[model samples]
Target: MIELRSLTKNFEDKKVLRGINSVFEGGKCNLIIGRSGSGKTVLMKCIVGLLTPTTGNVFYDERDFCVMTKRERTLLRREMGMIFQSAALFDSLTVLENVMFPLDMFSDQSYKERTRRAKYCLERVGLLDALSKSPGEISGGMQKRVAIARAIALEPKYLFCDEPNSGLDPKTSLVIDELIYSITQETGTTTIMNTHDMNSVLGIGDHILYLHEGEKEWEGTKDEVLGSTNERLSDFIFASDFLKKVKAAGAKS
Candidate 1:
């Protein structure tokens, strides 16, 4: 689990995050969602230690991440797994090799042990058949799966995904969402995702944080989102005609 206490970030004079406080529970999908420029990305970065909070605390499983020394931070990072908005796989490496990269760099295990772990992660993602293929040879969804396999290769305690379903068809997006959700539940990992995808919001959003203009505007489960009376959140959520219709239909039913 992760907890934020008065988390704030400032870029010179412009404030990016303003005293945001929330709890992301383990063994569930905790999502951060907002319109562009709403500070979701900055919030995620601060929580992951990529950016420093100007005047706040970020606690990881009750450990004060903000006060950790450089070496301590480095060691703590080994327990984290990250998936970028892009698949972010290396074109020069095979899929299996890509998954092994983290293990080789961080793990103290022997080469054979690392290989076994990498293979197991690939199999878990159902990509064992594509181990030898390079990132360039696969479709976008396959590349994302390889990225997921690589992220979980270390069996991390915390998983961070930034737009994991970006740039994929609806079918592929659902596949990725289900995969992430299942892995989070099975491993009991503290999963935090920064996404703008509404499909993801309703599909696997066990806990949702809604940010607006650098502050936490609302927070709730997916089931409560549609019934929310917060006008700004409602406007942002039902921006499209299709979603508006869905909301109306739900209201009617």
Candidate 2:
């Protein structure tokens, strides 16, 4: 599990995150959602160590990440995995090789061992057939799958996904969401995803954190979202007529 205690971040004179406190439990799909510029991305980056918090503690399974030394943090990162907004696969490498990259860089495993592990991860994400294909040769959804494969290649204990469904069709997006949800459950990985996709939130958000202008506006499960009384959260979520209709129907039921 990951816990944030009074977390705050500042950039020059502007503050981004303000005393945000939350816990992301393991073996569940923990989602961070908000509109653009809500500071959701910044929070994710801070959790993943890309950016440091100005004040507060980020604890990963009881370890205070902020106080870790360079070596300690480097070792800690080996237990983490990340999927970016884009698939972010290497253009020149085959899908299999791209998955193998992490193992190659961090593991002392023999070539055959790494190959076996990478192949297993690829198959886990339903990319067995695309192993030999390059990133450019596959569709965007397939590339995202390959990226997922790579992210889990090392069998990380913590997984972070930044808009994993970005740019994908709704059907494909659901597929990716299910894959991520299943993987997190199966591996008991502490998974946190930064996304703007409402379908994803309702579909796999075992835990949801809503941010507004750098503050943790609300937190709850998808079931609780429909009944929320927070004005800003309601306005942000039910901005569309279709969603307002859904909420009304849900209320009637």
Candidate 3:
């Protein structure tokens, strides 16, 4: 599990995150959701150690990650897997190579061992036959799958996804969502996803963190979210016609 304690991030003089506290349980899809510029992205970056927070601590399985030395952090990173907003695959490399990149850089595994593990990871993501394919030769959804395969190649204990469903059709998005959910269950990874996709919120958001202009406005499960009395959350989530129908149906259900 991951814990955020009074987490705060600043840029120049502007504060993006403001003393937020939350618990991201392991073996579940913990979602950070908000409107654009709600500081959700900043919070994710801090949790992933990509950005240094001005104040506060990020604890991974109870250890404070904010103060770790470079080597300590690098070792910690070995346990982490990340899928970015874009698949961010190395286009020049084959799908298998992309998945094997982590092991190549971090593991003592031989070429044959890396290839075997990478192939297994690809199969897990339903990309078994695409090993030799380049990123540019595939569709957006397929590229996302490759990214996921790469993320899990090392069998990481934690998974972080940023806007994972961006630029995909609804069906593809749901597939990716289900894949992540299944992976979390299989690996017991502490999964944190940053997204504005409400469909994803209902589909796999075991824990939801709602951010409002840099503050943690509310936190709850999917079922609890429908009954929220917090106007900001209600408006932010139920504002769209699509979400309105979903929530209305949720109310009836």
Candidate 4:
């Protein structure tokens, strides 16, 4: 599990995250949600050790990241699996190569072993047929799946996803969300997703942290979120016309 204690960050003179504290559970989909420019990305970056907090600590499995030496931190980072916002696949590499990249970089395993492992990851993400396909040959959803295969190739203890369903339709979004959730449960990986999508928040969020202008405004499970009385949270959550429509429909039933 990941824990934050009095976390704070600033870009130049502007504060981006302010004394944020929350625990993201292991083996579940823990989500960080906020509008654009609301410090969500900063907080995620800090949690993953990509960004250093100016005045706080991030504890990953009880080890404080701030006090670690550079080499120590790099070693710690090897335990992390990150899925970027764009899937970030290499255009020149085939699906198999893309999945093999991490294993090659980090593992002492043989080529044959690497190929076998990468292929297994591809099949796990439901992309066995696309092994030889380049990134351009696949749809956005397929590309996202390929990215997932690569992310988990390392078999990390912690998995971080930045907008896992960013550009997909609702159906595809749900598919990706479910895939991430299933993988987390199967691997017992600590999964943390940064997203602004409410559908994701309601569907796969086992733990949710809401941020507003660089501060955590509220946090809870999906059920608690729906019945929350926090006005800012209500405005931010129900602000979506689509969410209001869903609420209206639910009320009628």
Worst 10-residue lDDT window for candidate 2 reads 194-203
Worst 10 residues of 4 by lDDT: 242-251
Residues 1-253 of candidate 1: C-alpha lDDT, one tens digit per residue? 9999999999999999999999999999999999999998899899999999999999999999999999999999999999988889988899999999999999899999999999999988889999899999999999999999999989999999988888999999999999999999999999999988899999999999999999999999999988899998999999999999998998899
Scored against the true structure, residue 109 in model 4 reaches a CA lDDT of: 98
Model 3 agreement with the true structure over 1-253: per-residue lDDT tens digits = 9999999998988989999999999999999999999998889999999899899999999888998999999999999999998899998899999999999999899999999999999998899998898999999999999999999989999999999999999999999999999999988999999988888988898999999999999999987887899999999889899879987897788
TM-scores of the models, in the given order? 0.97, 0.97, 0.96, 0.96
Q: Which stretches of candidate 4 lie over 4 Å from their true place?
A: 249-253
Candidate 4 local lDDT, 1-253, one digit each (tens): 8999999999899999999999887998999988889898899889888888999998999999999999989998889998899999999999999999999999999999999999999999899999999999999999999999999999999999999889889999998998999999999999999987788899888999999999999999888888888988888889888888887897798
lDDT value, residue 162 of candidate 3: 95
1 or 4, which is superior by lDDT? 1
Worst 10 residues of 3 by lDDT: 242-251
Q: For model 3, what is the C-alpha lDDT against the true structure?
A: 0.93
Task: Tell me which of candidates 2 and 4 scores higher on TM-score.
Answer: 2
Candidate 4 versus the native: TM-score? 0.96
After superposition, the stretches of candidate 2 with alpha carbons farther than 4 Å from their true spots are: none
lDDT of 2: 0.94
